[model samples]
Target chain A: MKNNYDILVIGGGPAGALAAKTAADAGNSVCLIEKRPAIGTPVRCAEGIGKELLKEFIKPDPRWIAADIERARIISPNGTAISLEQDKAGNEVGYVLDRKIFDRELVWQAAEAGADVIVKTRATAPIMENGAVRGAKVLSVGTPADIRAEVVIAADGTEAQFARRAGLDTVVPLREMMSCAQYLMTDIDIDAGSTDFYLGNEIAPEGYLWVFPKGDRTANVGIGISGRKSRDGSRAKDYLDRFVAKNFPNGKTIEAIAGGVPVCRPLACTVADGLMVAGDAARVVDPITGGGIGNAMLTGRLAAQVASECIAAGNCSKEALMPYDAGWRASKMGTILERNYKVKEYFVTLDDAKLNTLAESIAQSSLKEFSVLALIKELITRNPKMLLELKALRDTLS
Target chain B: MSTMLRINRDKCGYCGTCVAVCPEDALELIDAYLSLERECIACGICARACPLGALEVVHEE
Candidate 1:
């Protein structure tokens, strides 16, 4: 085994790609590895990003724009609909994207910035020298090889392999994780600019249903139920299909995707000696909704900044990289993600009637004035619904 | 070819995602643990979907 890289990023997802690109842009040699031969194969996400939050790194290229970015529709438990338009003023969200293309585009940026990407390379183990991780022992395309670097970043999504091997505590409690499933259908009757949100346990117990319209009558219809309740004999995809079957009689199913969303906050420690974690790997995902794209990209950029700073000082130790944690927390990404996690637990525990009433109450409110916190407070403000539910939400949350 | 899944049984919440993604029908949920009884090819499909780090395939020595 011989050392050759300044930065080695494992996994070619958003976080890995961004770290490689940013480090390369800073003139550090980077080696980016993906376990799969192709960059982004077998998509596992709903492929949605808040376009407003994407300016942290590079400008939004027209090629990266998946569909019309704009407002969303809120459907109450009783099925009351309330619409919000950007013209009326609300948070701007992007439409469903072709994740395969979006992932490849990020890789292209890394390559242009001077990083070498090797696909089908599985980083099976960390290469530790003197109790400090130097790089990795990779099984590249079925052949064993040692690829070394000064700093190694694991961006392997929610199931972070490198993080676990480096002896970091990588766990997102089952109750906080969302068991999500999706169906891609065509000829769907949904507006391209409006994302449809269905929240109420009766509709999709312990979770919500989403319709991400991508024009051409095609959309990603999905549901995400909390893992705690989902395991108790409920199928999220079944609920999603029932919703689809009831609503879009004329639509045709094209594809299906299933996965879990980490609705937990960033890990207590995301960096160790010569090793760092980013994106979904560190659980830097949203707590309110189980979304990770905006947050993942944000972490990617922040990790890259820290790596660059480390290289300039010729020290990529864990302590040298702690500033990345501080800087990221200072950004809105940390506050919103951690707070949203607490907020999600509250909604996940609500029953059918309570959720429905909460939905209806929220639908009745003005869109611009309706925050996620407002919906929870309206649902269980005066009425102490369940001691366990409240305890589950408020406990263990800082 | 069983998934040869090793679970930190304490961490298993029986989410059943590993069972759903198992192309080989190698896993089943019992007492909040995903039991790997049948042949598991170590495909890793189940491992990726397990959010709690409960399921993994250990190759035979």
Candidate 2:
């Protein structure tokens, strides 16, 4: 790769790939780097994306789309299952992606757009000049090289080391970190067209378990619990193992993947001098659902757009990059993130009985549009005792 | 004299789950290898956060 470019994007996930492609499409020289040797091996995500959201970036290619989810089922602690059809299920009911192929397609598109793509390249440190990030010192395939660029986009996912090294506090709070474990299991009975979510503290404390069908009888069976709730004997894997043992006893686990997702607020400042953070690196994952693929792509594209603008103007200061942060927070994704964070906080506080009561109450009524607000409104109307708490939440939204 | 953290490479998935929960910023996942820095305080948060039970905290005499 070149030692100099207009923009350098760290990480090769959806965020970095989109950033690179967007910037290159804008006629800016861009280079994207991935620490891993391959694009999407050892997939960390559940690979589910909203159909509409996926449409915003790229067409749903069958080569990458594993399952087209037609509905969703929310199972409460009391085994009360609430199902919603595709039209009413909002963004949660969409496509289960094969991320291995999906991520590679994104990078391939980025490369086709005139951006350079390099794998097995780790950004060792930021190349700071007078307290401004000029680029990165990367170890590409064991040979270290200092790459310089006018702007650096940190799309480095959950580890977020590049941002931290560039003087951004990227540490996620222990309580907000979702310790997750997932197993790709086959030979299991599953609704091929429906995604299932199991809620309650007994199963996943302050979190939830999910079963997203890939195809046929194979599915991604996963659980994510609060980091604070994790301990030696009772971790995310422990919970997932117990659930799989009871439910899918005959299932064969072909792949086991574990990672941590930041469910906290995004960084107070996602941009610094000559640097912009995007995707999971910015902690923009949905606090409630732990979904971030769409958000990441959104931020990545926005960051590149803003970076290109600043580069054209010959200014890459933090002030110039501030619009990237403001742009996302003002978008629909931003408003949803703020609302979901609050909703996640409120739901995590509910006990099994409270959840069961709420689930039972909601199960009786049908929501035309299956949004979080719609569900909460249903809860407020059905449960008089939750009126005050739910009203307070609504007030914050307004 | 200090708390020690040991990682069983065989069991470690190198998914960087430990790196994310590390308050001390001690753990770094380099490709397939997971490394520990001197900043590690041995809080065992990473140990607990490890889904594969690949990490352990040991107290030495």
Candidate 3:
């Protein structure tokens, strides 16, 4: 079967649609495909997106907002606490989003930009031709038909079949990935503008649990743990359920969803011949927070801009697409994401005693500089061994 | 009425796990992304595997 397009973008998610919109806006004919018939369904996200980050890509629209949050509180294993004080001005953690509405808006933007979108259609594989990605072969009726594109953007998320088919080997170690499960619950009498985080091995081993309020007495409550730690030990939902049952037993769960997150650095290579990957497939989620919506959208825009460039120049090789790679790392989002991964790795390894000591110190410290990084440095002062291990990671700081 | 699931492109991760675990092969990885072919019975297994929390299943309303 002959397949062809100026640009054939697979996966209509944030990355793919953005790629399509951007390319279309740039005067490239584009096709945006989706396997689902509707735009946003299933509700896998916690819906907590930083307001500041979203403002960078597109205007913040109320249609996509579920709730606005202001403060963040962290709870230790024994419930010891440390928080960024809140006075109700919306300072710390920001919005709890309406993921469904937000996704539709993006796709609509793409369509408005002139990309053709087809729902309930899935691309089966990258149609490899002469070792250069030309397009994809989709299964329309148990029969494979190829759709050719000068360039293919695999906004396909973490399990990248396009790159894999193209023979690009980039795997996030299981230990570096976080398994996540979340519940949208209602009737919880908690602070509407505050988000809570619970850290420490006793509560989450290699990860943490979060309660992000979403107004109307509802909240997105979830937990994630390093894959290696939770793979055989506890299912993500089980961990979340145990915690919720223990803490928010009276809170009624309205919906449940489970998934995984990549907290590692970006893949060693984000582009291959005729293709570029973005979002989760590229492991762009924040290492410490396990958040990716902002990054996914940002990376999607970057990928689209790069794809358009690739089409105009008629070259889609690694050399031509180097700007996407360089620019992404240079972006603040990239810097913070990589830095947080290091912080997460370092923080997860700290024991309860170390945690308690660190929390106590943060609670009482007023001698000088008050950056979170500075406090971590203070904790390391009491434990030189930790300093040695963290020294290499200290370079991980941007 | 024939049914189709819609993926809000903004919310999709083209992970083919939908195709991988789809018994009907309704979901397939195309161009390193996902699309539904004629075989889609609307089983949502592929939506489950996305780590980015991007996949969704919608009915033709």
Best by TM-score: 2
Write model 1 residue lDDT over A1-398, tens digit each, in one string: 33489999998988989989988999988999987768876677877776666666556765655567467787767777766666654555554667788889999999999999998777878999887889999887678998988889889876675777788766556556677787888887878777888878767666778888766588888888766655323556557767888999889888866677767667888888888899888888777766777777778878888988897899988899888878778787777676776776566666667665545554555544334544445444433655455555445344
**Cα lDDT over the full model 1:** 0.73
Provide the lDDT at A80 for model 3. Answer: 78
> Mind giving the per-residue lDDT tens digits that candidate 3 earns over A32-54?
77666677765557788776777
Task: Give the TM-scores of the predictions, in the order they appear.
Answer: 0.82, 0.98, 0.81
Model 1 per-residue lDDT at A383: 38
Candidate 2: misplaced stretches above 4 Å? A87-92
Q: For residues A197-222, what per-residue lDDT tens digits would candidate 2 score against the true structure? A: 99999999999999999999999999
Model 1 chain A — which ten-residue stretch has the worst lDDT? Answer: A374-383
Where does model 2 sit among the CAPRI classes? medium
Candidate 2 lDDT score at position B39: 73
**Best model per DockQ:** 2
CAPRI band for model 3: incorrect
Q: Give lDDT tens digits, candidate 2, residues B1-61.
A: 6689999999788888788778777888999889996477888888877777889999987
- CAPRI rating of model 1: incorrect
